[model samples]
Target chain A: AQSVTQLDSHVSVSEGTPVLLRCNYSSSYSPSLFWYVQHPNKGLQLLLKYTSAATLVKGINGFEAEFKKSETSFHLTKPSAHMSDAAEYFCVVRTNTLTSGTYKYIFGTGTRLKVLA
Target chain B: EPEVTQTPSHQVTQMGQEVILRCVPISNHLYFYWYRQILGQKVEFLVSFYNNEISEKSEIFDDQFSVERPDGSNFTLKIRSTKLEDSAMYFCASSGGRGRPDNEQFFGPGTRLTVL
Candidate 1:
C-alpha cells in the first residue's frame, strides 16, 4: 500500500516571500510524484510532476518541487508568492509498475495556501 | 490547449434515482479516470478505464457505479442508485501515457451532484 502525507493543512505566506508546502510519500518502488492546484470550486490543475528524470522539477506558474529520496519527501516551493498562487495544493503519488494504469495515483489530503498581500 | 470536458455542471436528483455523469477526454488521450470529492474533503478515486475496459476501481466504486465509453469520444459514469452520501463533486480525468511522468492526467471542471 502506498500513501502520501502533507505536512501542512494550511500555509500562509506574504507576497514576495518564499512559500513551501511539505509532502512525504511511502511507496514500495520508485514513484511518480505530482503537484496539483485547485482553485476554489475548480478542477485540479497540474503544477508539476517528478518522473525520475529530474529530481528538481519546475512547473507552471513559477511553482517547483524537489524530490528527496533520503527524506522520502517532495516539497512544493515558489520563490515569490503571488495572490494567484493561493489555492489548495495536493501532493500525489503513483506507482510506476502497477498493472492497472490508474490504480496507483493516490492523492494527499491537501494543503491550502493563503497568500497575504 | 486541449482539455477534458464534462457535462451537467450541477445535477440534483432524489434518492434512489439513477444519474449519469459524462466526460469527453482530450482527443489523443488513452486513459480515463473518475474521482469524487465530498464537501471540504479529499478527492477519492472511483475508477480508471483504459482500452475500452475497466483497468482499476476503488472500493468506493461498488456495484452501484459503472463506467462506459459509449463512443470514441465520450466516457460516462453511471450511478445506479443515488444516496445522500453520493452527493459530491465528481471529476473526470484523462491521460495519454501508460505510466510514469509522461502520464499527466488532465481533469475536467467536474459535475456537482446533489442527492436529495
Candidate 2:
C-alpha cells in the first residue's frame, strides 16, 4: 500500500523568511514522489518530482524538496517566502505502474501555507 | 509547455440531474484521469482512462460515474445522477510517458461542481 502524510494542515511563515512543509510517505517499494501547489482559483501545478536519479529535486518558483529514504520524508522548502507563495500544497506518491501504462497516485491531505507580512 | 484543460469552471445543478464534465488532455498524452476534492478535504481519485477504456477506478467511482474519450482531443466524465454529496472541485489530468518513472501528470484548472 502507498500513502502520503502531510504533517501540517496549515503553516504560517513571515514574509522573506524560510519555509518548510513536511511530508511523509509509506510505500512497499521505492516510489515516485511529487509536490504540487494549487493557488486560489488556479489549477494544481507540479512543484518538484523525485525519481530514482536524484534525491534533491528543484522546482519552479524557487521551491525544492529532498527525498530522504531512511526518514521516509520529502520535505518541501524555500529559502525565502513571498506573499504570492501562499497556496495549498500536496504531497503525492505513485505506486507501481500497471501494464496499461498507469499507476495509482495517492495524494496527501495537503498543507495550506499562509505567508504573513 | 502543453497543458490539460477543462470546461465549465463552475457548474450548478439540481439533484438527480445529469452533468458532463469535459476535458481536453495534452495532445500527446496517452492517459487521462479524474479526481475530485470536497471542500476542505483531500483530493480523491475517481478513475483513470487509457486506450479509450478505463484502466482503473476507485471505490467512489460507482455505476453512476462513467468516463469516455469520445474523440482524439476530448475526454468527458458523465455523472448519471448528481447528488448533493457530489459537490466538489473536479480536476482532469494527463501524462505522456509510457509507464515511466518521471511521467508526471499535468492537471487542469478544475471544474467546481455544486450539486444542490
Candidate 3:
C-alpha cells in the first residue's frame, strides 16, 4: 500500500514571502507523485507531477517541489506568495503496478494555504 | 484546452432515494474515474471505468453503486439508495491512457450531493 502524509493542516504566508508545505510518502517501489490545488467550490488543478524522471519539478504559478528519496518527501514551495495563492493543496500517490492494467490514486489530507496581503 | 465537465453542480436528495451524477470526460480519453471528498476530508477513490466496463473499484463502492457509459461521451455513477454518509462532493476525472507518465487526469468541478 502507498500513502502520503502532509505535515501541516494549515499554513499562512504573507504576500511576497516564501511559502512551503511539507509532504512525506511511503511506497514499496518507485512511485508517481503529484501536487494539486483546489480553489473554493472548484475542481482540482494539477500543480506539478514527479514521474521519477526528475528530482526537482516545477509547476505553474511559480510553485515547485523537490522529490527527495532519502527523506521520502515531496515538499511544495513557492519563491513568493501571492494573495491569489490561498487555497487547499493535496499530495497524491499513484498505486499502479509496473505491469498492471489498472491505476488508483491516493490523496493526502490536504493543507490549507492562506496568504495575507 | 479540453477538460472534464459534470452536470448538476449540487443535488439534494432524501434518504433511500436514487441519485445519478453525470460527467462528460475528454473526448479522446479512455480511462474514467470517480472520486469523492467528505466534508473536511481527503479525496477518496470510488471506481475506475475502461472500455465501458468497471476496471477497478474501492471497498466503498458497494452493491448499491454502479457505473455506466450510456453513450460515447457520458459517464454516470448511480447510487441506488442514498445514506447520510453518502453526502459529499463527487468529482469525475479522465486520463488519456493507462499508466503512462504523461497521462495526467483532468477533473471536473464536481457535484455536491446532500442526502437529507
Which CAPRI quality tier does the interface of model 1 achieve? medium
Using TM-score as the yardstick, the better of models 1 and 3 is 3
- TM-score of every prediction relative to native: 0.95, 0.97, 0.97
User: Tens digit of lDDT per residue, candidate 1, span A1-117?
Assistant: 778999899999999999999999998888889999999878999999998898999999999999999999999999999999999999998755556655447899999999999
What are the runs in model 3 whose C-alpha is more than 4 Å off? A98-100, B98-102
**What fraction of native interface contacts is shared by candidate 1?**
0.70
Which sections of candidate 1 miss by over 4 Å? Answer: A101-103, B97-102
Ranking by TM-score: 2, 3, 1
Q: Count of backbone clashes for each model?
A: 0, 0, 0
Structure candidate 3, residue pairs in collision: none
Which docking band does candidate 3 fall into?
medium
Better of 1 and 2 by lDDT: 2
Model 1, residue pairs in steric clash = none
Docking quality of model 2: it rates as medium
Report the lDDT tens digits of candidate 2 across residue range B14-47: 9999999999999888888999999999999999
C-alpha lDDT of candidate 3 relative to the true structure: 0.93
